[model samples]
Target: MAEKAIAALTEAQASEELARLAHELARADQAYHGDDAPVLSDAEYDRLKRRNAEIEARFPALRRDDSPSDRVGAAPSEGFAKVRHAIRMMSLSNAFSDEELQDFDKGVRRYLGLGADEPLSYTAEPKIDGLSLSLRYENGRLVQAATRGDGAVGENVTANALMIDDIPDRIDGAPDLLEVRGEVYMSHADFEALNLRQAEKSARTFANPRNAAAGSLRQLDPEVTRGRPLKYFAYSWGALSARLADTQMAAIERLSKLGFRTNPLTKVVEDVDAMLRHYAEIEAQRATLGYDIDGVVYKVNAIDLQDRLGFRSTTPRWAIAHKFPAELAWTWLDGIDVQVGRTGALSPVARLRPVTVGGVVVSNATLHNEDYIAGRDAKGEPIRDGKDIRVGDFVQVYRAGDVIPKIADVDLERRPKDAQPFEFPHLCPQCGSDAIREPGDSVRRCSDGLICPAQAVERLKHFVSRAAFDIDGLGAKQVEQFYADGWIAEPADIFTLEERFGSGMQQLKNREGWGEKSAENLFRSIRERRRIPLGRLIFALGIRHVGEQASLLLARTYGTWEAFETAMVDAALMEGPAWDAILAIDGVGRVLAQSLVATMNQDAERAVIDRLVALLEIEEAEAPYVADSPVANKTIVFTGTLERMTRAEAKARAEALGAKVSGSVSSKTDIVVAGPGAGSKEKKARDLGLTVLDEDAWLDLVGR
Candidate 1:
């Protein structure tokens, strides 16, 4: 059996395939973007995404709501606070071949209505393989820093960002408010040195410079980030108060003048051929650049042209990334092992014989799920010609953008005679809990919640993780040791460590690895975190589907621990006004709301919450508001078309000014901005006696 061709697939078949693709891509996005770990090779992910796109193109109405085409990245990780980007950060479409690059050029020309004879300039630069960071400067002073998490919201790393010397603290001639977007990366030399230090301490070393740079920047303690050798390269801008320049090249130059490190290899190319040549040059110099780069990015040079081209749901139409080819190597499949995560999801990892992929040693790859090992997709569609992989088989490994390689294809002819099909476990390997898969979810999970030691230990580690309590000198290793010794079993036990262990039969200072000073410091750190913010506490609880953004949103919605707790308890019934209120949140859906309510109602979990609450002072969530803006705290609706800016731009501007932009016109809407072709929403606003203004009047009211 083979995959059905996009052109030959029926509408029902396409819909099912789209659903399958959405689920797989969502998991991949979370692993890569949220966890900073990629599960699938870039090539495999790209191929599936491309297939989904082609299917939707052929059957236009079969697209799913959670389609990969509409998503940029995963939600922000729970380890840090969340930052809502003023302007949504977008991903770029990719081109892997010369033909794709040519097609991209033609597509841009067609979108802008420019003829081939008309000259069009594009800027080409190396695509750095590192974390995307947005640095905001207000009144020449660096104010905030964020990672590109899910495009709309990101992790706040301002404190960690300040430690990087490449980021200037102040600029004398910068705009009143400017947001410079760039990459935060570690050089190869620095990465090697850092790994050597880790190895000396018997700690885990990073697989690549990208992972090291990302992990370092996301450290809970700013001092740890400060100790790492990290650098920044500014390449773009967002939410600028004033225009930096008219062209992309000039804008890069302006950023460089503002004390930002701009890439020296950036060049202006006149046509597709020039773009290709520049990309070739960059690829030729890739190895000697002293940093990692996987591709070259090409963007329309003229600001007006880029604006005219606008954006797709998740990517820009005016720019594309020319990626390097993926690397492949053959190796024997040694074994398959299952690892349990904090949420009790049992994920499988494939152990491979020693092999080198893309200049890195590879010994393991992701098995994804049982369905993947059985040579069928989620929709039961045949893959790899329905060839099931087994131990002792010769497997092809490939690396695209992932730090870990993935099994691409298997050589059936080379399969060992003693090879047998691998059987997935029906019970948790760590605790013997029943392992079950839920409807619509592909991964199998343990039935035992916190009772299992594996889950409990992982949850404890998460509780003390950088984004959570962030206790000094208390890391994953320490948490595991404490758990193994029965010193701490739950979140509440962590607070009682000093009281329970000090002057007891087994004193902490008398422990093999601990001394008086270290014990005292750890106790002091625990004491310092006795007063925790509401958002961090919520995230620390390790509730399913409740990440940093969701936790903050819940905190902001309720403001206090008491209010949040009471609301969750009331919403447990799942059919009242309380439940409706939870659903009313912009980002919270039925699944997330249900998870929060159920966790609150569970007796065991409630006891844990009560114990933690008794020992800690939870701060109320502060309202994120711009006090000086006239539209602050107001609800606004935009209708019809605007000549001055795109709808997304208007929404972003409104959000930046502290106004809430709503899609529907309701009585609660304080203002409505109407333009040409004003529709029923504008009429409804007028009927409701709401303030309705034209686009120009609305712009003037906001002082734009």
Candidate 2:
């Protein structure tokens, strides 16, 4: 509502908007300045201010007395001594495009009485997304430190600042009184580590680096502040008795020499094009960089030029902070719903008021688990600053790398009065089973086994999925429809569809969307898959921890269904060679072995499997790898054509045994398998001192 353009508003509409903006901005000011925890993202606050300015420009009389246009930010929070800065630490105007940057340059020229042809210089530095602080040094010793609250007055944090290792305690060749201004921030690695520690202690986890830094810095206990990993980057100074240098870049260099950390990306550029190019380069490296940066800040390089093109009411005329397009968006959370998985874990999803984020329309976001919804940890400790999301709360949703949706923060002030807490059900919604969460596990599971509709449906879907049976005419919608209409209940029932309904009085062809042709085609596809390979049959069973690789291992270990069943029966006795052999497969663990055996021993499950087996042909499994094979698990370079099998057959055979076949030979190549007419690859293999084997030798080793 706040981001709507001014040109789209009527006079009456503008008046209402002004009132709303005044109230929201005032609340945001209180949260940001007083709490040290901002409810709104900076981009969102900026957009609201921009909208207010635009509305006032279009309808001047509609502006209220409490308009946010006249204010810089909310007043300083209580508890710390207030320091009045000698020079006000002001914010910067924003430039989102190259044209805005070009306009900025043009405006500088007009103010300096210079023409477009003038060779003006500028300096660009990364605008670190962090808390702004000013450190005061007197008589070459650290004295005071304060935050940039409301631009003029700030809270003194000398004790907290003293704990930061990056701040110099004393300097020898310095001014009588020097005030160094910079950002105090936490790096990405530190933030992740902090979150892990928070999880262990059942404390609240921070949303991002900026929040972590701010929260750490504002702690009443200096001991808590001392424990946090904090760093500083000195960019611009506040008040200095002795001048460092004439130009911006030179001043930064001097600061570096004085043992202050400076951003290495800062550089002096000749024109606007260079500034844009630098911004692009920084944006490209944003994700890989250890710390967070909102944008690039550009300033007139020369001190004289900056003085000449001096202050606007709240910002400098000669500089601008070019912000990145927002990855985070504010939208109303509409409702919370639950989805039961094949593993019977009930996952909650937040249905949101549809909003476009980074070009994608996102309407649903994950709530993670019940603990996330209740603002607690595994032990029911508070988290996310103790903010529990209600249905009507306006929440900040961000996309990491523009793909994953995460709820960043909640605006508690905007939450409706009637909103209630989401009740994470103790009983399974899909089945009347007792939903149990074992100690130390995050997910709640249904104990009803195959009786649960959702779990059974999902298992059936997985059974016919592409990696399993992969019937041609079967898809998600068809499977869902068949499950709902009682046409299929288990994997075995699929084969009986034609015998039960084909050319009968109560026929499937009489259905609305499915006709004779479609039904016949579907039955034909089902018939084609009656003879499935061993690996596919094992995976289609959907036993816990039994994935494609584990299934392959089981299939290859026992050649036939009868042999596999007998081995599993014997393994269930708890002491046998059959269990040892199952565990001996390279990738198979005790958990998977137990799961497979337990699944096969269940009376109902075994009955289903027997019925399915009776209706189809189950092929014998083949073992491709043996311990005595010469090339077992070796990486081989296949160079030239073979006199016997084709190159494809050779590659397939090698891959089946866990051997990696490469097109080129390197130091890591164990051996080179060469054919009659060898090429440069064989030469390179010999040059690298790798063993070369002839086709006949390879064939003899594999018993071909």
Candidate 3:
């Protein structure tokens, strides 16, 4: 129901809704945490609980049984080698009940040598049930991030951390060094959606949102982590260049100003009673919150006092985690389906008979991968009780603090006679292309290059996407329609539409769903995209390995399309300086370079490129804009680099910050970095009166 409708409900109506909500929520909880499979998605359950909360908030006295105020916590998850933390990340003491919380408060007061009547402020906030992370920012830029592995040591997750949209790539006006501590968690909605996608492709689905977040952050491929819907909440600081604030709440507020999403419920309470009240309030609000939290955390507000209170062997003496008890349920696994992703990875999704759990209906879950379907691990070892999930199997599903609805277990005794093992297609279902799984890779991929209809359509979609050509009146539908009609087979065909069909015996205006004005508008939209940046054009090509960032890197390195095309053609001929040049482009490695050259080597691809080039005026990529840098957007040269870094390293570093690093020092050269050898290029720079920097000076200039 709409919020307005729910709000306008009479007290009697609300009371009746609450009663139903109580029963439904109870069932959902049992299914999510019990021996039975869950019947509700995390989002569905959260919405129902949120609805219950909204109604209860409006009519507190009319609240029914099984309210969120009585709920509790569950157990918590992933990959990678370990990196020791600079400082130990201590855990918090646990307080399961109000009496425990009070005792913890008393312990804090007694330790601090404060009288029983004296006021001792504490910051109470929701303890998100996800991975703990420590982000180290150097000179206002994120440098490293790590997972809390063993308090004293953790796995480096810097690459994955950078992928988080919530974490800033670069912060303005920050300290020289800052170590921000926070939780990286997935929301209920994102978790459910993620699981559905996972199940659709027959991939390994996460048991809960916590596992999803943890696994995402620990992925060896940062690109994989980038795809996950992970979020960060900065609650505290481990190290800082300067003091953030005197109080914990104020420090969190400062982090908020620095672009961190801090919990809104954090408050400075005056006494133990306020802390308990806040905890109860937060618990009631948990179902409505998008993220999963086991309980409310309370810490000494004063930073100085926190330091004085010190830590125990494992947990901090000044902080405590007051947990709520956890919530599971039984559901039927009806069937399984597959879904292909943008790059063509298949995932398996579970189709379930609709069941009520936690007061909401769950009709689906994730089956994960082919191995999961066959009841085996990645190595084909027996798992899941050595029984494959059948179509009519009774699966145990659960939703903990995390909102993802997952199959905890499957009972095969009730397997239907019609049940059969799912056969994963070796060919892409959408394009008839061979879907191959490479060695050391878990996911399979479509190998049709740009020929597959699915890949082509997806490419066309990207070509006209907002970040690419962004042609108006030519969305995905129009592109697909045009493609199916054999009117626009490639990017260039889009530009040829007006000339070919603007006014003819078979005009676009004559077609169904097309009018004279609309057809003209479509042509106009295509015409507007005739001139685009080289980077955007490269990105629109939809090469297998190249992404937006990689496209931009190539564009910046070559500056012009002609230079880039020539280099690529040369590289395709044989491995030499040209291939090395492509590989030398910081982010571009041998594999990516090979993928790019392979695309260019195809005759059909080259012909398409020729047609596209003939139709448009491609602009040179703009130089990197390092606003505060001395060499940004400037043409420069490096000569006689005798120490510190290799010549290629210097070129990559300079080009990354928008400097044009040329092979030779010429009249156009803005500056020349001259090392101890003092070569002829250095002399030329002096003759030209261009600025010359020594190796040491150059290093200092870039903050290296």
Best by lDDT: 1
Question: What is the lDDT for 569 in model 1?
Answer: 86
Q: Candidate 1 or 2, higher lDDT?
A: 1
Instruction: Give model 2's TM-score versus the native structure.
Output: 0.48
Q: Over the stretch 1-704, how does candidate 2's per-residue lDDT look in tens digits?
A: 22233454555445545644654565566556656555455655666666677777787645443457545554565567788887888878777668878988988886666799988999999999888989999998999988888777888889999899999889777778888899999999998899899999999887677778888987778899998999999998888898878898898888888889999999999999899999999999988889999889999999877755656435777789888876778999999888776767777778999876643456777675787788765445566677888899899986522223557689988889999988888888898789987665556778887888888888888788654787867766778888998888888989888788764414567777777677777788898899988888988887765655456656865778888889899898646777765654434555456667888888988898888889888888875555667777577777777767656556656764557566556666787999867888898888989989998888786668
Expressed as tens digits, the lDDT of each residue in 1-704 for candidate 1 is: 13354555655455545655665676678777778666666665666677777777776544543568777887787678999999899988788789989989988776556788799999999999899999999999999999999899999999999999999989978889999999999999999999999999998788788888989999999999999999999999999999999999999999998899999999999999899899989999998999999899999999988876777657888899998988799999999998887777787889999876654567887676787788876667767888888988899987776645668899999999989998988899999999988664567888998898888998898798755788887888999988998988998888988787773324667788888788888888898999999999998998865656567767876889999998998888998878777775645655567778999999998998898889999999986789689898787888898888767667767876877666667666789999999889989888999999998898899886
RMSD of each: 7.0, 27.9, 19.9
How would you encode candidate 3's per-residue C-alpha lDDT over 299-393 as one tens digit per residue? 99998888666654346778988877534678778778775544555656788787655434567765655666777654455666667777778
Ten-residue region with minimum lDDT total, candidate 2: 1-10
Q: What C-alpha lDDT, on a 0 to 100 scale, does residue 5 get in candidate 2?
A: 32
Candidate that scores best on TM-score = 1
**Which pairs of residues clash in candidate 2, taking residues 3 or more apart in a chain or in different chains?**
none
After superposition, the stretches of candidate 1 with alpha carbons farther than 4 Å from their true spots are: 1-121, 130-244, 253-265, 269-291, 300-322, 503-506, 637-645, 663-697
Ranking by lDDT: 1, 2, 3
lDDT minimum window of 10 residues, candidate 1: 1-10
Candidate 2: clashing residue pairs, number: 0
Model 1 residue 559 distance off true place after TM-score fit, in angstroms: 2.0
Instruction: Name the runs in model 3 displaced over 4 angstroms.
Output: 1-264, 267-335, 338-369, 382-390, 395-409, 427-451, 503-517, 633-704
Off by over 4 Å in 2: 1-5, 8-12, 56-69, 328-332, 335-704
